[model samples]
Target chain A: NAGVTQTPKFRILKIGQSMTLQCAQDMNHNYMYWYRQDPGMGLKLIYYSVGAGITDKGEVPNGYNVSRSTTEDFPLRLELAAPSQTSVYFCASSYLATFTDTQYFGPGTRLTVL
Target chain B: GQQVMQIPQYQHVQEGEDFTTYCNSSTTLSNIQWYKQRPGGHPVFLIQLVKSGEVKKQKRLTFQFGEAKKNSSLHITATQTTDVGTYFCAGPIKGSGNTGKLIFGQGTTLQVKP
Candidate 1:
């Protein structure tokens, strides 16, 4: 399996601009998540999905939106970019929600909002 | 709300020296998991601790889950250059139930000088 994959390894956006971060998993995981990590800071969940067509807000979902159109894809959207939104974003997936389940993360996308 | 906090945001060790990082959660966890992220890379699953006061080891690394199920620790017996990366601890959000959303610690960045 290719595990989880995220598009655009790095990007720079101007204030007020918008873009979508794409993510996909070949592992057929029912659980997918989006997280952001600031420099030297721990990650904060932005949004997540339990399965195809199901999504939920997370700890830091104000500036972001997400859609799980299929079991393999969970994309994040930024409506109006802000400098505070600049950070490394990660996509992850898990086969299940059991206590023993482990998350597999994709190489993060680094965003710079100017 | 749940929060996971990690101590010693950054640690630098000489080759062959030992290093450790600690993680604490504000709420009780059914389980805790550890992940390692290399510089410019995505996070990779390390291990999961489900039982209270659990201790697991992998090669030169040791992981422990607190008896209260709200704390954990990762220790490296002999630091190696390959160990240079950030370590993170994560747990499922209480009451979320089978959704697989997690709260992650800020993370501890280990720097080993060879």
Candidate 2:
């Protein structure tokens, strides 16, 4: 399995611009998540989905949104880019709840908001 | 809100030296997991601890879960240049139920000089 994959390895966006970050998993995981990592810092969850059509806000959901239309895809959207949004974004998936499962992460997308 | 904290934000060690990093959660965790990320690379799962006072080892690495399930630690014996990277600990959000949402700790960046 390809596990989880994310598109747009790197991007630079002007203030007020909008964009979508795409992620997909071939593992058929029921849980998918979006997280952002600032330089030299831990990851902060942006959003997550337990399954298709079931999305929820995570610790740092502001300035971002997500949609899980299929078990394999969970995409993140930024309506208006901001400097604070500059970070490396990662997509991950797990077959089940983490309490009893492990997560597989994708190569992150680095975003620069200017 | 649940929070996971890691200590020593950074660690530097000479080859053959022992290295360690600690992780603590604001609330008890049902399970704790560890991941390693190479420079400019995505995180890869290392291991997970489910039972209290659990300990697991892989080659030169050792992982431990606190008896209270509120902390964990990773130790590497005879560190090598290949061990240089960031180590992160993660756990499911305290009240997120089975959504499998995770909160990652501020990672400990390990620098091994060979």
Best by TM-score: 2
- The residue-by-residue lDDT of candidate 1 on B45-113, one tens digit each, is 899999999999999999999999999999999899999999999998889888887888989999999
**Candidate 1's error at A57, in angstroms?**
0.3
Looking at model 2, the pairs that clash are none
RMSD to the hidden true structure, all candidates = 1.0, 0.9
Those runs of model 1 whose alpha carbons end farther than 4 Å from true positions after fitting are none
lDDT value, residue A22 of candidate 2: 97
Docking class of 2: high
After TM-score superposition, the amount by which residue A63's alpha carbon in candidate 2 deviates from its true location, in angstroms, is: 1.2
Clashes of each: 1, 0
Model 2 stretches astray by more than 4 angstroms: none
Q: Model 2 over residues A1-114: C-alpha lDDT tens digits?
A: 778899999999999999999999999899999999999899888999999999999888999999988999999999999999999999999999847798899999999999
lDDT (Cα) of model 1: 0.93
| Collision count of model 2 | 0
